[model samples]
Target: MRDFTVPAEAGLRDAGLGAGTTIALPSGRIAYAERGAGPPVVFVHGLLVNANLWRNVVPTVADAGFRCIAPDWPLGAHQVPMPAEADLTPYGVADLIAEFLDELDLTDVTVVANDTGGALTQILMANHPQRLGRVVLTPCDAFEAFFPEPYTPLPKLVRLPGASWLASRLLRLPVVRRRPWAFGWLAKHGIPGEILDSYLSPIHDSREIRRDARRFIAGVDKKYTLGAAESLTGFRKPVLLVRAADDRIFPAQLFERLSAILPDARLITVADCWSFVPEDQPGELARLIVDFATDRRADVVEEEHGC
Candidate 1:
């Protein structure tokens, strides 16, 4: 696997997530950025993006006395590729997340997830809920909407030979990358060129990364999400379901269904954003996370003290 230093231009420094660290998991080496020293909060990003998705939100949460860990999951845009024998399926990736938390010995973790990451998080919550204290799910795939509408063809498309290569090449063009089918619908105000480059360059530059992407994409199935949704009622831990008020992809009914199913769930809708809530409303998202995490901790403390 290639060793990568956090680029100075990735805006990680500005986000207070300085330097990247590597962790050895059963799958392979994973690269992550972290900061702060309090309750642990892990950030999981979606396809074709890395930890940089949380760049604008990390600093504030870290400052709020929470340890923020953002890993560049092997989702095409990650700098490090998984081993050739690694399992990149939705179930496998969810296990990889459980492994990461176990390796770090992090308990009561507050998991904040976006996009495809949210689907993986749901799987993790279903299969491995021992370490998770609570969860924050922004607009993402759920129920039968795994990959959603315009994106439904992605799994099949990536299965075609050379499709991954063609996609990486096509995304290099500014016009193509900004199309609604591309990164355009995710954010409202548009991602910065530098940040977008950070997300796109890995797949374009590395054959192994493209291979990893293809494996993961080809393994996408809505059944995994449906299965997770079926088990959500058993996830008694607190959950914050965040809906983007103007999200064009994930509908409001998804969050409504989640709130109804999760035993201790609450739903909040944020205005003026699309699917990528972190990119469009980082400040508001961060505040909501910090409050949810800290407030839950306080409630636990009160119960422990018999107050």
Candidate 2:
């Protein structure tokens, strides 16, 4: 298995995410970082990103007396690839989350997710609600808009002959990734070079990684989310929906729609942020998570989710 440690230059430790660790799963070895020690809080990131997405938010929540576990799930940019024959579809990846929890013996966990991760969380809640305690979703793919608008073309791009390779090659240029239509829309501020490199290098260096990514892309569909929405309506567990005011990729109406669907959900809007709330509002995101987890009986919260 790969060492999977954060490089000294990346300075993840300084950002409060500490060193990396790995857990052996049937699919492959999963790399992760953990802090604090109490009822667990697991974080999930989206496509082309890793656990580093939560570098800032993890420690803040960890300091508040809860264990934080952030794993680099088998997205395109994960440092380690799943077994060659492993399934990389969205539902398959959702199963991986459930497997991770069962293997780690984590129970009644508060799952926090962003971007594509939120979509998976909805699936998990619908299909594997045994171990999860509650969930917090920051603007992500919902309903029949799995790929959203500007990004909807990605699935077809991955399916086109040699298109995945060409897309991977195009992504090699750092400048191209900084375009608004690219990863630039993910966060409101500039992403650090090292962090971005960590997210992009795996696919560049390994065909297997790219293969896994292509499979995930080909599996993207709104039906999975729509089905999850139906099951979610009956999900009585606590749910928190966080939306970024400045986000352009995911529609603002998603928060309201999701809140209305779930029997016990509250919506909060964070300003000056895009799709990635952890990057733009980690401090505020952390506070809301901790407060929600600690206060088990909060009267089915229906107030504004202000930071």
Candidate 3:
């Protein structure tokens, strides 16, 4: 095992590690962690959580005759210094991701996206169809401006002045912050100290990133997502939808809409998974990813994807 070290000047040079590769994005250097040796399988995380969220899944895919690269965006837990005025919309963020992907010269990439990332991946697949090989989306909150019910509306509220402070404080409460007990799934990615520190410490370490919570909320573009869905539903690539039976954030009702658009796409549901199914079922997810990536190319046909 090698060490992945992150530093300011070295910038994207290391992730306390000597393996993998990194590159400079518009905002700053992107520290990409890589391992194993084989075909490229890029793992991208959603907002709030960085590559660490994929820690459990990296090796699973890597060990299975595939190369894995996990890139840390400057916006999130990596705490990259944001420009005083950055357009952090879904398209804006996807542009940076596209830039990162281009720099890596990664063509035919099997892109795996979760949560907000799933939406971004959809955008990438639609806009940059030629660059994509296959896609895997899971527990994603795509397609709908109004977020699913029973979610911490605070994520959107975090943009307001007093709202973020309220969130930081509220998250500290055991009663209020207890992992959803409705199902035992969230327990896998619960707020344990190490998990909390790995995800939150970077943002907490830098007071500047307090603005990120604001940026994260403001970045949500329901329009862009809807358009991406429009494009992705007709995307000419193999797509696998990993549905968590107990996802609390993304309403399952929308799955019907998703299926209508992605008619040829296969669906895999984890009966006992919460919002963070990738963390809970990394191996299963990894296998599905490999299968999706290697499957035959599917052509797009125009139709009103049962929205």
Candidate 4:
């Protein structure tokens, strides 16, 4: 049990994040950002991103009296590389999430996820829902849409040697990253240059980080989520699906399907946002999550518009 704390004023100035911390996990050192204190809320992000994705949302929820923990999972953008023998499969990632919660001894936690993180959360709920209190899923890969259609090229690209590494290098180019097929369509507004740099640098600079990215990409497919869906019915915890209304990648109809699939789940549509709701509508997203966590959903969740 170790804590690597970074001064809030200096460490995360670029991302406007909170105190950065890293804990030793069985697979490797997992980095995270935490703030405030109360009930625990863990955030999970997808591949090629890190805890910084929650920079805007964390403070709002943390200030609302919840201890927010956003870990930089080994999904490509993480600074720390996993052990050579680490399992990087989708189910393995879910196990890591469970282990992370157990390591911190956080029970009855609210788990929030976006993009690929949501897919991993589904597996966690299916296999390791004991420590989870509730779940909030934003727009993400669902059913058989693993990387979604436009981006399905990723899995195949990663199969070819050195392809993923080369693609990562191209992401360093601002113009390539913001192209519609890239991150351009994911958020209504572009992420700040510095923050984007932080998200891409790990894979661009380190072969080990790129290896982690390739391992994750190679494992992407709908079968993992399909299997998780079979067991989601047993997860009776409160569930909220906050789908981005304008997301071009993840279909809006999936949210409608998920509402019917989970016994305790409801759907909320966030307008003027794309797949990256945390960056596009952080305040509204945080308000919805806070309301859900506090069991005060009449106003926040009900105000949702049709997708």
Candidate 5:
């Protein structure tokens, strides 16, 4: 985005994809890429992560006879603005996504979302119904988190005065430095480095990244809690919960609450992965998607694709 000149084909760089597609909305911008030539499968990543988080699973989904559209929203968890006091609210972010979806007129689209993506996808389910076909939420953060875990430091620090500078410094620590490593390892479940680069390509430093993270945490109450929270009532979308068994960010209870509330929802625990399920269990995730979309026709997944 240094040039903001979109990398051609409307950001749809991949062949047979809408490489540089920019779906303009009222809020800010929606940078997206689409691939393959089958049904549309929309992807949304969590807070700081971009739509590129879906990079690992896109090809497999496309290979399974589905098109992929991954969109990057503004002010992500890693977007660090210089001022450092950006008011990033979940309702605001959710509003941005809802507007993006409505503007794009992408109806009957299947969704695969991780982290913040999972939360906003739920927002989409609550607000827009016709546009949804199937939803796969992985390693979600739709409810209250970032309170009692290691990441709690994130919210507390982000809100402090001039927090961006400190966040930038702290993220370079050995512990924080390993995030990219962990991120790479997760994506190793399916994608190659080139694709993984897209996932990590969003930031060059912490200052540029910290602002987004702060906003993501601060916005949660507004986005999902106050606004989108009440909207979750009587939701009937077909949801597949691809959970990370060991995810501390969003625990099992959250998934259980979702499974209990969602009229049609199933959960699958992905072992050996954190909150990043697409990267943790692509093959299994893909298989479940195929099964879920095809009405639990597990054999169809193996037979139709032989993947």
Candidate 6:
């Protein structure tokens, strides 16, 4: 574990995540920002986005007396690129997440994940549930819906020669990026220009970053998500499924199925939002997280005391 300074971006600064920290994992170093103190709440974001995805939600959760650790997972938008030999596959990334928790010695953690990150969290829960006390999964890929529709061709497309480079270059254009096929549909209200820039600049500027992105994209397969789904029934930990009322990407039925699968799970719907609930409903999301963590902790204490 090492402390480091990340170039302060306006988006991150405004989010008030405090100083950045880097943890050396077997795969590579992961950059993260943390705020507040007490029980840990780690934020995991999906592909093409970084820790900034939680910018609006972290402060509120942290202020509620939970230590919020948001990492820039190597999902294309991260500042630090992984080693050339690092495994960026879905299972490998899931292990990387487990390694992250172990390296930090974060026990009984509350993991909050969205988008592709939610799928990875499911994998972590199936394979590495020891550290996690509970999980909150917002809209994300699941079941056979991995990559979902319209975007399903991504894995095969990235395997094509120069596809990563061309895609990165095309995304640099504001019009192209804002198109429905790109990031436009992710957030209903739309992401701020600066924040969106922060999300895309890494892949657009660094060859290594593009390589990392390509590796992860090409490895997208539904088997990992399906396998996780199969194992979720045995995961006795509490889970909160936060579904978007108007999600254009992940269907509402995904959460419905998840609720049916998990032994202990609750499902709630948030209105007027798309896939990015943190962006569309940050305050509500934060409130839900804090309340769930608090309520679950209290329940545990009562059970321990036989109350």
Please give the RMSD to the true structure for each candidate, in Å. Answer: 2.2, 4.5, 6.2, 4.9, 6.2, 1.5
Q: Which candidate tops TM-score?
A: 6
Better of 1 and 4 by TM-score: 1
Give the whole-model CA lDDT for all candidates, comma-separated.
0.91, 0.85, 0.64, 0.86, 0.61, 0.91
Model 6 clash pairs? none
Instruction: Give candidate 1 misplaced runs (Cα > 4 Å).
Output: 1-15
State every prediction's TM-score relative to the real structure: 0.96, 0.91, 0.82, 0.93, 0.75, 0.97
Sort all candidates by lDDT, best to worst.
6, 1, 4, 2, 3, 5
| Worst-scoring 10-residue span by lDDT in model 2 | 298-307
RMSD of 1: 2.2
For model 5, the run of ten residues with the poorest summed lDDT = 77-86
Q: How well does candidate 2 score on lDDT at residue 296?
A: 52
lDDT of 1 by residue, 1-307 (tens): 3245664434532355646777888889888888998999999999999888898899999999999999889988887789999999999999999999998999999999999999999999999999999999999999999989889999999988899999999998999988888998899988998888888888998999999999999999999999999999999999999999999889899999889999999899999999999999999999999999999999999999999
Candidate 5: tens digits of C-alpha lDDT, residues 1-307: 1234564323323343345456446665456777776666777776556655655567777777777777766544222232334334655666666675677666667788886677777777777666777788887665565232445465556678976565445544445545642332233344454443443344434445555655666545433543554666656667888878767566788888877777888888878777777667766777776667666334346768985
- The runs of at least 3 residues in candidate 5 whose Cα sits more than 4 Å from the true structure, single-residue gaps closed, are 1-5, 8-18, 75-88, 146-148, 173-175, 179-213, 226-229, 296-307
Better candidate by TM-score, 3 or 6: 6
Tens-digit lDDT track of model 4 for 1-307 = 7677753322533344567777888877788877889889999998788888888999889999999988889998887789988989999899999999999999879999999999999999999999998999999887888878778888888899879778888998988998875688888877888778778888888899999989988888899998988898788889999988888889988888778889999799999999999999999999999999988333334657432
